[model samples]
Target: MTSSEPTSTRRRLRRLWLPLAIGLVQVAGSYGAYRGQLERREPDALMVVLALIGPIALYWLRQRPVLVLTATTISTLTFMLLQYPYGPVILSFVISVFSAVIAGHRLAGWVAAAALYFGHVLGRIALGINEDGIYQSLAVGAWFVVMVIVAELVRNGRERSAAVARTRKQEELRRAGEERLRIAQELHDVVAHHISLINVQAGVALHLVDRQPEQAGTALAAIKEASKEALVELRSIVGVLRQSDESAPRQPVPGLERLEHLLSRTSGAGLEVYKTSAGLPHALPTSVDRAAFRIIQESLTNVVRHSGATKVGVHLQYGGTFFELWVDDDGNGVPETVVEGNGLVGMRERATALGGTMTTTRSPSGGFRVTAHFPLSAEDERDPD
Candidate 1:
């Protein structure tokens, strides 16, 4: 058998032991308590059956709380009406009432407690059993009220704990979803940018192989460099999924600090890229820096793959409160009916995730232009030097 079978059996036994023990206590304790009250009715077969039935019904309390409460209440009231000596015979009834309340059956628990208390008092009055006075009846009423209040308090605590657990689970699920989206964006940026360069250089190499074999060698070298960079980036992104004991990739993440390297790689693909900066340059928040780099990278990739232009201009404007990035190409712009693809959507998501805004439009030079603005916090304005 599987290991779970034994564990399941143990759990069942643990659940059963409590009610069984209480049943035994009810039977034995009532009989013992009855001996001290010689003036009351002597214990008989009916009393023994009544005491045993209440605790037996308790075994199903968790599954059918209201039914168990009803059964135990009837048995206990019958025992009281018979003028049997007062004892621990009511223990099963008390346990069932508390279980009903804690299990979210407040109405059933309250009604059952009221019926038992009033039934005992009225039954004694109807039978002309005046041995106990009104003070005893009032005292029993007060005790029942206390029991209900205590049960209500315990139920409230359990409900609050359950709500907190549900909220925590939802928060964890939300964070996991966001992390997956980030990884997807990273993979898309790395694969799309490098693959576009490789495709362009391969075409150039094929075109010059027989005509200018020396020019073909340059194209082949560019292909090798692009592929090597792609592999390094792919390894770094995939390393996040590896086991904790495994060594993580030590490659630095690409940010605006590596913009010159990115521009050089683009130029190798036979595109004339011009970069310009305005205003004072300062440090940026890590998130904003990475987002700025990826946005520019994706924009350049789009130009190489779709635009037939030979000249492209990249500009960075560092302002006091907002950092601006613009990429313009002297190529045929996108058609108005063209739908946004994954590359464009991923770029927008990256920008928006860092409280940045991006826009794409036709430039004055009859080419496509992408512009983005990222707001800077006070800490980002400080110079690293």
Candidate 2:
């Protein structure tokens, strides 16, 4: 907690000084009235003045609620023992009870109120104020009971407000967790896919320089394309994370329609791929399209990095309510030493978030294969783009 924060003493006094000051004035007026009612109207100069300052002193320690209540109770009992009338002298003690209850000291407040009320009544009667009448006695006790009830109500409201604040904080934390997972998935897919392609194309350029000088240009061109796309997508991710209002356009994340760009780069890495898409190429939802593109991009990158596959096949099929993706390569199947990697986990998470499934297995053609199926919403259609 910083000194400038609201919890600091200066801020707390600013917020609560109003009610305490009002209560102090009320107590002072009550003391004046009690002195006027007595036969010996001369104020017992010391106790009367102490009663006036007692509540104000307690107000300064409003942060130490229990101490405020306890001190006020002692002061009130001392005033009564001196044969003081049932007067505004007790008003400060009531305010203390309210303070303690509102501070979540409910049990202590109730116990203090009970003890002080009886003590005041007993002291008044012993001093002959009760002999005045039955009506006066009933009225004094009733007022004391009302103060206790009011304090309890204030405490209940404070507790309810605290409960609501706690619930809202928990909800915010849950949303933050989901957003962090999504960002992590995005970084893994973008970096893994682009870096793998660059690594393969660079190797191709190096190998062909001596034997096929002209083809090296093609490999370098593919590396350039892959790096450019990676930069754009990474920029979009950064724009989403930036706090400033001034930002670059980040909409339209990559989709399967842009899959040819990835394929061209993969081909440059010396992988021969046969691609087929059935049905008209109607557009898909950004979420579904992005996931599909990333899934394919990752699968091909894995093939280049781990599968040692030279020839690959990719199939895309659209249906009324769902779309399917399949990628297979003719290579020495998935190696037994291979383990599930971050790319595979990222792809599966993306599919599941879109209410879909992604699966991978050893293909019948003696290579690895990956399949993804995602349900489509009406929003998936993008006006034939």
Candidate 3:
């Protein structure tokens, strides 16, 4: 048998054992009680049948709680009225009350318990067998109250457990959504930046292959380098999906430390690039550092793809509370009706996700400019040196 087969068999046996055990207990206990009672009527066929009715009804209590409770209550009251010796015959009735209450049938369970108690008392009085005093009645009432309290507590505990399960499911879904967004951002940054460079170099190689065949080698080489870098970054991003036992790519995550390599790649695309920095440089939070790098990388990619500018400038500002990134190119400025594309949207999302802000507008040099500001935590502002 498969693993699940044994578990299923165990569950079936678990479900059956309760009623079976209760039936045996009632049959044996009632026979013993009958032997001890000399004043009550002697054991008869109908008495044995009545004692078995409640336990039989209990077998269906989980599936049909209200119906089973009714059946057990009637059988129990009839047994009491007939003056059968008191014993474990009422066990099924008690189980049914708890089952009904826990099945969200509180009103029915309460009424049934009250009816059994009052019915026993009233039935005894009507038959002129009211020998038990008020103290006995009060004691029975206290036990009934205790039973109801315990059932309510079990019901409350089950409800709380279900609520906790629902909250955990929602939290897992939320984390899954965030992870998807992060992967999308990473793929976009990796593909867009490198592919833009490769595209430019490919065009240059084709244009010079016939007239300036000697210079075509340089363009072809740039294309090869760009494609190699793209593959490395893609592997790094895709490594997150690997199984725990599998080896992952050991590439370091891109950050401001890789700014020179990014600038060189952009310069290779035939753009004259200048870089400048202000304020003291310090180690940044990994998230802020990565976001800043992506914003600048995407901005440079947009310049190469859209702006025909031969020159671009990148500026970094490190402050006590914030890190800033700016990229401007001296190409045709953005048209008034130009719509933002995925590259720009991804950059904005990265900045905002890190509690930062980004803006895209036409620069004073008559070209498009992208600027982003990322906040720094106290730890990020600390000097590592």
What lDDT score goes with residue 1 in model 3?
89
Models sorted by lDDT, best on top: 1, 3, 2
Task: Return the top candidate by lDDT.
Answer: 1
> What order do you get sorting by TM-score, best first?
1, 3, 2
Per-residue lDDT over 1-385 for candidate 2, one digit per residue giving the tens place of the 0 to 100 score = 7766756777767756754674566456656767666753344666656576556656565578787777778777776666655566766777778888887788888878777767767776777664546677677668778887887887788888999999999999998887788878788778887898899888889999999999999888888988987898888777767745686566577777678877877787778977998876677876788889989988988888888888998999988778999999988797666588888988899899989999888898999999999987665564423
What are the TM-scores, per candidate, against the unseen true structure? 0.93, 0.82, 0.92
- Please report, as a residue range, the 10-residue window in candidate 2 with the lowest summed lDDT: 39-48
- Which regions in candidate 3 have their CA more than 4 angstroms from the true location? 1-14, 382-385
- Residue-by-residue lDDT tens digits, candidate 3, 251-368: 6788889999899889988999999999998888888888888889999988899899999999999898888989999999998776988888899999998889999889999999
Best by TM-score: 1
Error of model 1, residue 177, in angstroms: 0.7
Candidate 3, RMSD to the unseen true structure: 2.8
Q: Candidate 2: misplaced stretches above 4 Å? A: 1-31, 39-42, 56-60, 80-87, 125-145, 278-283, 335-338, 376-385
